[model samples]
Target: MTKFTLYLAMAISLIAGKVSAQDTTFELKVKLIANKIDAITKEEKEALKVEIEEVNKQLEAGTITKAQADEKKLQLAETRSKNIETRVGQAQEELKDLVKQKVDGKLKEDYRRKFSITFWDGGPKDDEGYKKYRDSINNNRSERRTTSQFVFAAGVNNLVTNKAVAGSDYRYWGSHFYEWGFTSNTRLMKNNNLLHLKCGMSVMYNNLRPTDNRYFVTNGSQTNLETAPMNLRDSRFRNVYVTAPVHLEFDFTKTQTNAEGKRLFRSHESVRFGIGGYAGFRVKSKQILKYSEDGHNVTVKEKGGFNTEDFIYGVSTYIGYGETSLYLKYDLNPLFKDNAVKQNNISLGIRFDLN
Candidate 1:
């Protein structure tokens, strides 16, 4: 049985064992009626907890979403709550019978044991053995070396110039980037959280805005940011990529011992740092130019090859506590194909290890 039920039964047993035959009948009726309510409440609560735990397992297994689990739990709580009130009313009727039996000296003092044992729902499936079995299974979950979480990051986007990660020729605040993906982190050492290998597939959207009224231009196999012929209100360039990233992460979270004395190592519970890189092909590129023409606003979107590198590779790193981290990445490959002065892409951002 659950701790709540056991403690209650113990208290009632103590009181009942000490009560004398000289005790008033009215006092005995009140004690027995209240104990009946407590016993009923405990049984309903235990059953409801079992149902909700199953829903949570389904959510973690990806069989149902979090919303569904919440809904199921709410429904079970409401049902059990109503059932408690209804059953308490029925137990009150038993009090009336007990009153009549007591007047005739037929209400046996041994009836306390009946209430105590009945609180278990009366079997191996519903007693202390069942609770112990469930607890053992929980503490001895199947061994798993890998776990997964959703990842998303966003921040300013610019290029490294002369080894500095700054937007030298581009608008610093206007350029930005966003990354969203799923990652799996695998433990490298048995019963340890110090090191892990993190790998993932991500889609990246990197944007750049040139300063001094400039926009990207393509000439044959060359691409450069050139001064626009028209005074532009906005000039922006965007690149998209599907990249696979791998990182060697060091997690400093302490390993904890469960009730069964087994060690449990979980990720993202403390300070963590990761150093790794990504490699992938540029999926697409585009340029946007917005200006006023003859007192009317005009927006132009140009989609082309732009002579940007088809394949790209980059170095990235992050360091922080738990779910939030400072993220930085710099592309090692040249931005354009065979340029005399190669320009590389760089980005600084905030990442969320959203599970």
Candidate 2:
């Protein structure tokens, strides 16, 4: 079970068939302790060698100073030396028990069976037999229907006002949206992997940059984009949301018929399509403005509700083969509430599913 037990077994077995009247228990104890000390010294010294190599590599890579490396080496050497002393002490205690058992006729051939090489059993005695045994266990396993994927989607973000996207106030190139999270896909049918219900939680960041020197201003629960007094270098508004998304996915990956006549489905290998919607609550809303005031550069950060909707719902779709896909999503709720000109946030991006 433990290495020390194996060492004691070896010590006893070494002199078993050739024991002479001159071989006393004290001599046996001396031999056993000497072997254990040698083993412990070798083990600790090798470990110390590996640690010293790592420290040297770090120093060569400029990650540590010479003094730091020297200090680390000293610490590692001290640790290994202590380990040698402690392990040898433990081995001596084990040796004492073994010597007592030897005198009392308790130490027998069965004590050496833990090594596995000298003992014979009905199954898996050799390396080839053990490998086959392991393979049999692996081959009998079945695949699970539900699997998870890490989702990532990033693209341009913009606003559409009055059902018009061409003349929106936000600059399309300057605005962006990033979505990342994890999703789980479960086969809807027991026999087929054709249709799956995919659902997950995600975090999304949507940013908007006004075309002109404008920023959002809030007045009595009303938020509007208006021109700033000074010529602004940069002005952007961002909204972060935690959303739950659900999609019905069509996976056309070919199924494999194994020797057992089972259908093994490999998802995302061929063309696929997914249609879904998301609903979420906004985490936070903030605006940043940078401008020059009287020959001095200044930056301002404004955080508030800004009359923005706290609850958001959206429709999204993706189509592609394998792990990469074309993605698009549009908000059903307006960007600002109770405004004469209603604007909705929309985005198009590339999606990746790492399963």
Candidate 3:
């Protein structure tokens, strides 16, 4: 009974020692990884600052020409890229080591009793464990991805119509106008080659003019005849609307290497095509009409009072390159519902992504 007790004490002491050693190693590994990551981050920042300062000095001293400065910029970019790659590799290795240690410790605790052993020999091999750990680290990095963007656009619209005449002659008249809207694109999708979706809301102001024409009228008896020409003037319309648009953009372009030998995906140059629809609600509307004969401005007729419906629906098609997207939209509803004005509103404009 004494010998048996002595053997059990020895086994317990060995197991306790092994556990203490593993715990210390695990803590030390964690500290080392943290310290290394901090060191790498500080080094990367300092290197970037130094590079920028050197470029500025070169530009100020004229020792390096503009072209040479550009070349040096490329070099600095490559250096930064390489530094990032190195840091990622180091992080991956450190994580692999930490994971291996943990797995080995757990395996030993769980499997040691069954096999009459103090440590697990069946823990993941070094290479396989490293790969698994690196994958986990990459997953964490992917979760941190973010992007920013910006956009701007302007457009023109014209109206064509004829004068209202009873018996005389009909003439063609039209007016040209313009509108502008600015918005920034906030990116909502991220995979390098996948279709990206973005949405933005913008405030647009438009100025519209309606063309006018005049007709002659002859009224008389058999002995007397009189002719008079009536002067017609155009009406200018101004309105502000809030527009919201959603885009599903696809980038179909080849990745190219820049002068610095870094792979850059050129945007805006990508043959980007998107189909989107916009909904705009009128905020304010006013009409300014000019009488040609009287040479005075007059208030023209308006449809849909302020308390009524003030919304416009438009479906747009976008086909263009890069940051500039060419768009064509047709208003779904007529501008005036009560009037028999056989006219449709159409617009051609450029869309920009600002983020």
Candidate 4:
């Protein structure tokens, strides 16, 4: 019994020593992999910082807003994470190769087989898992997709002032104006789809027709309203703008089941509204003078600044149910640049959006 016990002790000691040596080697390999991952992460972090700093500079310069910068940061972080993961995967492959080379035949085969089972189980490639992943991706894409609407608006446009100017009366029908634009609305909150931000470009035409046979003439930097020297049928001052508008819109449209039992939520279908403003530079200006010149019926188009404001800004609001709404807008800035009168623009019209 003593001899048998002595042989068992020797065998156990040999096994323990072998296990200790293999544990040390495994720990060293783990440390090496950890160091490599750290290096990759550090390099990527530095690059990300430089890119993010450039975006911050743009935000400071007012070239981009805070929201835009935040989006860029998210994109950068996602890309950086992907890059680091790829590098770590390569490091893992290198580690596996090194282990195979350094370890003895049986130990190498055992470890290599274990690593293959542990690290390369080829995660979740079954039909069920693949279907779930694909569905998740599709849902995410649908949520992020942006929708567009074509908007058309027309109404009577006139100048609003604290006090009336001497000769600045406008004929109602003749001073009619129109606006058309294409807008895209994006939901800012994932959970709350009621709030959205809308932005787009529009073309606005403001036609001002005087009460009497009068026209606009610019002298130096100031515009003067004057009567026609001769009998004039029609005279109008036209201003055009290429503007970008931004709005915070609320969509209270509710989801409903159709005849086919499919659930549908049409945008701007229920009680919906938006309050926003626009800022844009002037595109062009023209004066259409229709009068008898040299005994012949002549139409003259005068193209110039006409002392019109170059930058236009206005507050706008819309309220209604369904796709059509009553639109109201008032310009905060003056219509004319250097005029004796401080006349601002106000308009009320119907706005339609095909969403």
TM-score for each prediction? Answer: 0.60, 0.60, 0.41, 0.56
Scored by lDDT, model 1 comes in at 0.73
Worst 10 residues of 3 by lDDT: 216-225
- Best lDDT goes to which candidate? 2
Runs of candidate 4 with Cα error greater than 4 angstroms are 1-145, 163-168, 257-265, 293-295
Clashing pairs in 1: 1-128
Question: lDDT of candidate 3?
Answer: 0.49
Which pairs of residues collide in model 2? none
TM-score of structure candidate 4 = 0.56
| Per-residue C-alpha lDDT of model 4 across residues 1-355, encoded as one tens digit per residue | 2222322332243344432222423434544564665588689999999999999999999999899999999999889967965786587566544433333223343453344333324462455765566445434433453577666566667888665433448875557566766789887665455787889987787888887787887788888778889887788888988788898999886645544554443456567799999999887788888888787998989998887889999999998666556788878899887777689987766665554
State residue 317's C-alpha deviation in candidate 4, in Å. Answer: 0.6
Q: lDDT of each model, Cα atoms only? A: 0.73, 0.74, 0.49, 0.69
Candidate 4 clash figure, as a count: 0
Candidate 4, poorest ten consecutive residues by summed lDDT: 1-10
339 Cα displacement, candidate 3 (Å):
3.7
lDDT per residue for candidate 2 within 197-314, as digits (tens), equals 9999887889998988999988786788899999999998999888999999999976666667766766776788999999999978999999999899999999888988999999
Q: Alpha carbon lDDT of residue 270, candidate 4?
A: 67
Clash tally, candidates in order: 1, 0, 10, 0
User: Cα miss at 173, model 2 (Å)?
Assistant: 0.6
Error of 4 at 327 (Å): 0.9
